[model samples]
Target: MPRMNDVGGQDGFGPVIEELDEPPFHADWEAHVMAMNRALIGQGVYNLDEFRDAVERTMSHESSYYENWFRAIQTLLKERGVV
Candidate 1:
């Protein structure tokens, strides 16, 4: 079964626009969210695949990518009783 994030070749999806000069992050909190993901992965708390799966299963399709990352980490931490 296709997960929420697997939109490849799917119809009704809008075009994906690439930003030529997009900033590293649109918000300060986004940077923190990315860092937290990296740190947890490095510490073996969760692998990249696990994070992606959690985000895809847990977050809404309309949620931003960074928001998904934040939600995935929060879910992992709660599962581990770290937060």
Candidate 2:
């Protein structure tokens, strides 16, 4: 079965679009969320593939990338009883 993160060779996804001149971030918290994911990985909490799976499982398409990353790290840490 295709994992939730698997988007290759699939149809029905809408056209990709980019917002011109979008700000680096919509909010400051987003940067923190991203950093947290990296920090946890660097601390040997989890590897990148695991992190990706967690994010895929925890988030829907509606959630922003950073939002998914934040949720994924939380889910992984909680599952490991670290938080």
In terms of lDDT, which candidate is strongest?
1
What would the C-alpha RMSD of candidate 2 be, to one decimal place?
1.6
Each model's backbone clash number: 0, 0
Over all chains combined, what TM-score does candidate 2 have?
A: 0.83
Candidate 1 structure quality by residue, lDDT tens digits, 1-83: 87887877888977779999999999999999999899989999989998888898888878888988898899988988988
Residue range with the least summed lDDT across 10 consecutive positions in model 2:
1-10
Q: Where does model 2 exceed 4 Å of error?
A: none
Q: What TM-score would every model get versus the actual structure?
A: 0.85, 0.83
Tens-place lDDT per residue, model 2, 1-83, is 76667889989889999999998889999988878788888999998999988987888778888888888888999999998
Candidate 2, residue 78: how far the Cα is off, in Å: 0.5
Worst ten in a row by lDDT for model 1: 7-16
Q: Distance (Å) between predicted and true CA of 62, model 2? A: 2.0
